[model samples]
Target chain A: MANAATTIDSPSEATIRERIARHAGAARVPDRFKIIADTSDFFRVDYNDVVVLGERAFWIKGYEKEGRFGLDDELKYWVRRAIDLADGTTTILKLVFHEQFETRIGEVAITCFRSPKKEARILDLVADHPNFMHGRWSRDTAGNIIRILEYIPGRRYDEIIAEYGAGHEEYFHRFFPRVLAEYIELVQAIKFLHDHGEKHGDIRRDHIIRDSERQVNRWIDFDYTYRHGESMFGFDLQGLGNILIFLAGRGDVLVPDLYRDQRQLFDTLWGEDLNISYKNRVANLKKIFPYIPDSLNRVLLHFSRGAELYYETTDQMLEDLATAQAALALHTGRGS
Target chain B: MSTQTFGDLSRRDVERHLLVAVDESENSKRTVMYLADFFGGLKDVFITLLTIIPEPSEDFFPTEAARAKWLRDRRAVMEQAMAGYREILRAVGLEDHQIESRIVIRPCASIGAAILEEQEKRRCCIVVVGRRGISHSEEFVFGSTSNHILHHAKNSAVLVVE
Candidate 1:
């Protein structure tokens, strides 16, 4: 209860709608629609109220993938916000459309771990982990499988970064703590999955959500999480590291970097150095803003670049996150 | 010489059929005017003004009085909405015989599909419709009826007025 004053309220209905509309526009096709059933009795465009079935709302999320292969072509991967459709609800409907990919920049492996059953399994493996959304599964009449799970209400982590990370001296400091807390929580999330012998295949920034109330960050989408014969949670950890830099506005550093070249500072994130893989290194948060406190910077730096001293297990990462969170919080015990 | 179904027209006088969908919206009104301006004088065109009334909101119950009132209100609304369309078509040179109208009350399902089906069955060469030209994001959640017909009406050439 100590962090009461610091707990940010969720945006108003109007604001949420405006934001969802803007965010929904990111998808390539005209997709952000609710499928109206014979239940035409009720049709509302209010974003806060999702399409409800059997007294609960199911939110349909589609992240746009543009030209990952074809020139100017686009596709959206649909994920039904289940499990948490309601506070007590646990099953969700997940839709997937088969698509092809071709790209010279990277090996285009489409539909590798796209089984609904696999996502259900991953959720079960990480259930009660506080960070991963959990659910059960059943198929609809159309044979489209429904993965029921908790529906976490929040914007994507990257959406927030894109929305608020203006890097203005005052606003940056004001919003950075919560954003940092989200990263730390996500680290714990991945660590929790890893310790239990599971991997969250896709850990992209868009795959993570900062709950509407701004209380916690939750990792989402196991569609491409699994890698064949790939051991060690390092991949997920590295992803979390990259997301940290991304959430800090691509570490753009519009101002001159007094101590280090801006290009060198972001080498890990943008693949400036040929040697470092996208997941291997992450830019330091300090690169974005020199005013970023050293304690927070050190944690992100170690997580991003340091190998051995870095978090090998989630507990190790969790311990440091606790410290960083405590040092940065206006008050202890983030009970919103 | 033989007149088709409704009687009193010659077979050799077969008219090119046009199906135009109308709703309560101003865009639909624009569509009516557009059809009149573009196809009014086409050699022999039979124009069908189609108005699809989606089943009333969920709360309209099965009670006799409620059902009767719903029916009465829907007919009144449809007639009122189509009055302007009928006048515009007639004003543009279509006689009572050349121009006709029908209102469909959907028990359930899509207005777009109904328009396409009617256009195909009626051998309507061209389907005139109103395009709200809504944003993809809005169309994503709430589909644009005109946009759907334009893409899915394989048998008919759709003319959408924005």
Candidate 2:
């Protein structure tokens, strides 16, 4: 296997030696990438680095550039301060920078460290999401000062979802259930955010990570998250429905049989005519899954009702899913 | 947890000691200086710089053989970092007898936890690290590792130098 360290350009043997010597000198090198200090027991310097103090661990990130503009420094500061206050156990630090001339876009290098208590929390979360992949970050002192952390690994969920296509039952069988579960989870998570007076303005597959092993899912990239009042219900509902429709199938294919049922339920609650769009979505689902079973279609149709009629609150939909799961269990002798 | 107390001793009374950590950034020189200040000198301090080799991702390449080759290439880079750390120590006047260093390859998510585990097993008294400077906004959005260590260094004192 290729060594993980080999891919990146770290300090070289001679460079490290030179750095040590330079640090010992009174006149310091002004290069953006030069080392600043080297002593008997510790080493300190800048390397496109950022420090995040978490409740559980301290995360140090290293980047390749100096600084950037257009980035929300204020937001970053607030988030760091908030994490420091929310809990005292885990911390995250990131290193990012843009080119000297091109200050609009920048690159990111992140490191995460946790205390024992926070470490346990991370371990448990990772364990639950076995499919989730990450990079290794830590401190190493064999000869010189070094810290390492793992970067996020694997293909993004959106890429995988796009590859599979929305209509393929095989794809749906493998990922749809998880996607549905994620939608529900997102609703709940968003509710939590809302209760806390936060609004995740941007909610999409790119923001959510999926782990296949322990069936774990998480939302990230809160850069666009915001705070809005309860009056934002219309926005939230529109976004939710759009995401569901997008995930279920976009064009003329068979909408998941379960979702068809959900549409009817949604209509009942909202007292709105969604027949045109519903029919189009069902057609799209059929095209996606040509051989979908009639019985499954019935179930999907039933489930669609929840989307149309009963989903005034996120909980209402969750409760309906639970009831449906129990009924399905009695019918098929299988429980999720 | 059982706390083992050792009688207070002068700096001269303490024997040889080693500090192990990784240089995630290219600024090992700065990190080294911070360590020197933290521990008083490089005379009795043996620093070991190490890096972990992560498992190759499935998308590393198109074929298994290609992926394997890519991994091999990556390993070479990690080895180079290890060598660099060794050279840095030598330039600072740390003899082989005083400092022993190597790079380790392992697949794990939490590198900080691993370092602490090794420190406890080795019974080290201090851990010296370099601090990453991040904007206040980013820090609040994402937590930091150095901050975590600052709060939880129960057995060993963590000296975070910028």
Candidate 3:
């Protein structure tokens, strides 16, 4: 009879299985548990840490990316330091391979990393700059690493809008203030990075970590950070403008008149005569966001006016943002 | 050039005199050659060669005698390189009176600071430098000296030749 295990259709699958088997043999897991499933992306092993080592154990994430990139040792040193400084109630360990596993011990989540080098730097930065991020790490059986982040535990603003539907003008009134606050905080974090001579190149919604309990939202992921002194002010502002458009829901509503006003101001101050491509995109803004009210769109466009003056300095931008926020509050009677 | 007319020139106009800055690397030779070609006809151009020597740290301390010997060896090397640069200038048909060369020895840690100090003292208009590859620290992913000078120098336009 032919061996059923070796009868996999794909060569890649077979290779992955072989690699996982080798790792499983070397892995320090209980003998009662075995390698239940394996793949090129990850390996799922069944093992009881309690039975083998007299401790509650969980699954180990065997990563292939770690094997390819190898360990960045310098980064690991920093990661270790950040973890030590973080809340130590949960057990978090750094593993040899490049993977992170997170387990919940009671109420607190334990986060670990296989290669702590890059992620550790990120964690340190987030901890030092609370306005920037909220991240943590933990380790797993078989020496795999895991990162247990506080899941962004709230609904997206757009989702909330859709769920409430029509006949919910009161709901809109209740949520608008909170939405504006979130936008202001996000902009503040961006300004902070700029003031510190750094550029947070990636500023997507996914990268924005929100903690509703603390009424705080922080920017995360510093892999794309560039020293502000080295990059052109024009380029940085361009990125900031693009991020604003992205956050405004990519044309789901009317292109805010505030966006247009800001673009004009940006052009005048920065001398950034955006090419035909950008002009065309901006001209057709109404098509992109049909749902947004004309008044709200006008406010959005006004919000961009400060962006034009971003080239002066981050401090100036922050001051402008504060003024704009005040004006917006007065107009809306939000009394912020 | 009339003295009264010279005074009438704006700061920008006076600072337009191109100053080519070079290191002691092999690539600096190419940089010098390229700069010479670029500013060949410019009348008020000045070329200054600066070499940053790493100061003896605790990890690299030498005996008194060894330090003296090392200084002598470095001076000899610098003298030879200056001679080669003079020949390069001559071969490129640069007027002997128009071209000026100086070899500066400064601490490596403050190379950027030294360059800025020299530029201010010399009233340099534009700075021509060689582009270096990745460094060990990864602090400045691009050429460190060029990037530093570009950021810190208020009056100079930096031209980095790869």
Which candidate should be chosen as best, given lDDT against the real structure?
1
- Model 3 chain A: weakest 10-residue lDDT segment is A46-55
Q: What are the root-mean-square deviations of the candidates from the true structure over C-alphas?
A: 22.6, 25.1, 15.2
| Candidate 3 segments whose C-alpha is farther than 4 A from its true place | A1-118, A128-133, A136-148, A155-178, A193-201, A224-229, A232-239, A246-313, B1-17, B21-45, B49-90, B95-118, B121-162
User: Residue B62 in candidate 1 has what lDDT?
Assistant: 25
**Candidate 1's residue-wise lDDT over B53-130, tens digit each?**
765432223234765687789789889888777888888876777677888886434568778878766777788888
**Fnat for each model:** 0.00, 0.00, 0.00
Look at candidate 2 and tell me the lDDT of residue A234.
27
How high is the lDDT of residue A242 in model 2? 44
> What does candidate 3's lDDT look like per residue over B1-162, in tens digits?
212222233442553455566655777788878876766655554455555443322211113465467666776787777667666766766556545566665444345666777777666777777776532212211125676777788687888888
lDDT of model 1, residue B45? 66
Tens-digit lDDT track of model 3 for A122-180: 55555656556555543333322234333335433333434442433433344444555
* Candidate 2 chain A weakest lDDT stretch, 10 residues: A97-106
Name the best candidate (by TM-score): 3
Order of all candidates by TM-score, from best down to worst?
A: 3, 1, 2
